[model samples]
Target: MAEFFNSISRRKFLLTAGASAGTVLLAGCLGNPPEDVGGNAAAPTTAQPVANISSEQAPETTAVKLGYVPIVEAAPLIIAKEKGFFAKYGMNDVELSKQASWGSARDNVEIGAAAGGIDGGQWQMPMAHLITEGVITKGNKPIPMYLLAQLITHGNGIAIADKWQGKGVDLKLSSALVSQVKADGKGGSRFKAAHTFPNVNQDFWMRYWLAAGGVDPDNDIDLLPVPSAQTVANMKTGTMDAFSTGDPWPYRIVKDKVGYMAALTADIWKNHPEEYLAIRADWVDKNPKATKAILKGIMEAQQWCDNFDNRQEMANILSQRQYFNIPVDILIDPLMGKYDMGNGRKIDDRTMAPLYWKDEKGSVSYPYKSHDLWFITESVRWGFLPQDYITNNAAKAKALIDKVNREDIWKEAATEAGIPAADIPTNTSRGVEEFFDGVKFDPEKPEEYLRSLKIKKANV
Candidate 1:
């Protein structure tokens, strides 16, 4: 189990400020900012009169509200608070608010209802698009959103009911399960899956998985947008024959023997991007230092959670009322790689969780520009973007995608935080993602990919 950091105390907050100021003064005396303060920047030789300023003079903001859902993946935010990591970074007064749903979470951040919000991986792209397209309204003006860091990856999976067992549905491997579903032709036995929202990771993965399995998701099955928390219950009542969702739901279904694992998303696409630390772009510009500090705190918390030894403890923490609010056992199953799919199937596989910090060449920091173009390709495939969107004006499309990359800001913050630039992954690679059936994804050739699909794109 993860060890929770000692909670922040008023004295510790004050002490942190004193320590920051002292380090700055020492750097001034040595004619350089401390290597720990600004890693790669040359030590500044000129000492300004402001060097003597007291710790109390440091900028302090209060009532900084953050919105998040009560899910296991949101552990970093909760840990940062419980561990006093935020306090170490100068955000002493922070409020972690539990949002009612993903829509409310997005609205809270869009309308400045909270300084930031935590949501599923799937929502990140749509949120970026909403901000860029001026679709998110805030005080009658468009609100720009920016991704600060990736919180986790591969925390979601697909669940199918136990009745499908005799019919030959197996989650362990991605064979021709969907093809058999189509051959069954049970009419009303139509497999139904649920997602929280459109254009999020769930939608993309579910769509990709179905497409990879040779089942036309749009035509072969009914796709429904249902709340993540309600997915298991809905499955139990036979409202859904199968669904793709995050940890607790899939774990709950399998534990209750309601469903069998059809496939794990991580196995579908390894190291896939998931949740992100998101904030309004305006807020980012207004408080660059504070934003950097927030990233630092969350980044550290994520590292703390990624340790295998901390899984049980982390699950316990998330199950609290302020967090996921579920039984620790339910939260730990998928987290610990134990799969119990009620109909006599138990497989232990390491499921992907949150991966916050990357250590490359001895330097550690967050992954930037990690959102792939496959999402855009999927958007085109699903008719969310016009067919000519990428081909007719590739540069314009690239620019639209690059607007959400935020590499510049991440680089600046990383530099300030002492992370070496060489430690970050600069190259973005895309190919046809291979499914168990041997099909590959090629982002560079979306047109070819689309042409190869057997199903017709839905009319938008």
Candidate 2:
């Protein structure tokens, strides 16, 4: 009789516990996820199935962890989880870990998911290559990483503090601003600018824009790496002159009356390569099928994100506290390619929006090797990587790009996802790209491209 009583109590305990767990899950589905205080959040449990991957193509594993900074480029990853693309592709247990910053994302990728870090997610240009080469990793440990796909193109910009208004700070630096910078230098001060990470996409954008305006990035001003939130704060206090960062923050600057955008990356270089989706090399090798499944999920998500009709709902999902922690209003205008400029100059063009799957040039999702070459070549120009890294040793740089960029995997995943052959790119190169400054970069002859740049640090 006592044994029977104990069994009954155990059954009651489980029943009660199960009921409590259900309530919590329902709450999670009904509202924003619990605040991500510990650098990670619970897997989004609201799966509604956006695709139909067959059982035969089911992934080897249904679980993976990815890290992302709160920016527009991370939309595909977040949308895939929320809208059930991951679940449809048998990645039902995918976790979208919220990284505090790009540095945190890099560190998390190095440690991987097993050690309370991420397997990989979104990254800036050449970061995967640099990480693979041990140039940026902690202790210079070479962490092999694979560049899977470009997440989005042209959703970033440089913002200037409101104090610089009419002081001639725009896409091109005015002589007025230049003279002020020079005068400030005499007082042992310099115009201060910041990017989230050094020698990466944001840094390169800021530098390129400054250089194009005849402002030497390395010598004329004080450029430093700072987190997005801190940069915004500094802008408010009038201590920061300029900041190069992704959207939401830049838009927030205008919305909060702190600053105005100097130039959209789209204006600087139309259809430029932005952030990307990459994964740990070890994780991809161990679970090749799963890797492809994740890619298929992201591909579907990218297509969905590009649809203008879906952007309103996309803004809602991205604004959740667990993701960007921003208002939906700030995101919708940018997603629709409408900008107020905050300085009496407004732009409203769909072609200028952040593109995911396809754009005027071609497949925005395809990770072209040529794009990788351009990043490496730019690194050479800025002296971030050794000069011979690309100028004198083209073959060596190409070999590294070939090793890190996995466009073949993207093709295989696209095919398996039933994407049409017409949509798949035939060539690895995107051809010559022209900048707003009229400078062109040809992947075929990076040496000549480097030679044409008058403001570059590379001797070649």
TM-score, per-candidate, Cα-based:
0.76, 0.89
lDDT tens per residue, model 1, 94-130? 5676665555555556557443443212134555654
| Model 2 Cα lDDT, one tens digit per residue, 1-460 | 2233223222321111000111011111324455333232333345476546677777889888887777899999988877778878888788877775666677778899999888998988988998898877665678999999999989998999999898789978888777777677667679998887777888899999998887788888888766677666788888998988888788888988999999999999999999999999999998888999999889989999999998887887777665665667788899999998888889999989999999889999999999999999988888777776675548889999999999999999999989999999999999999999999988998998888988988887
| Ten contiguous residues minimizing lDDT sum, candidate 1 | 17-26
Candidate 1 lDDT score at position 364: 25
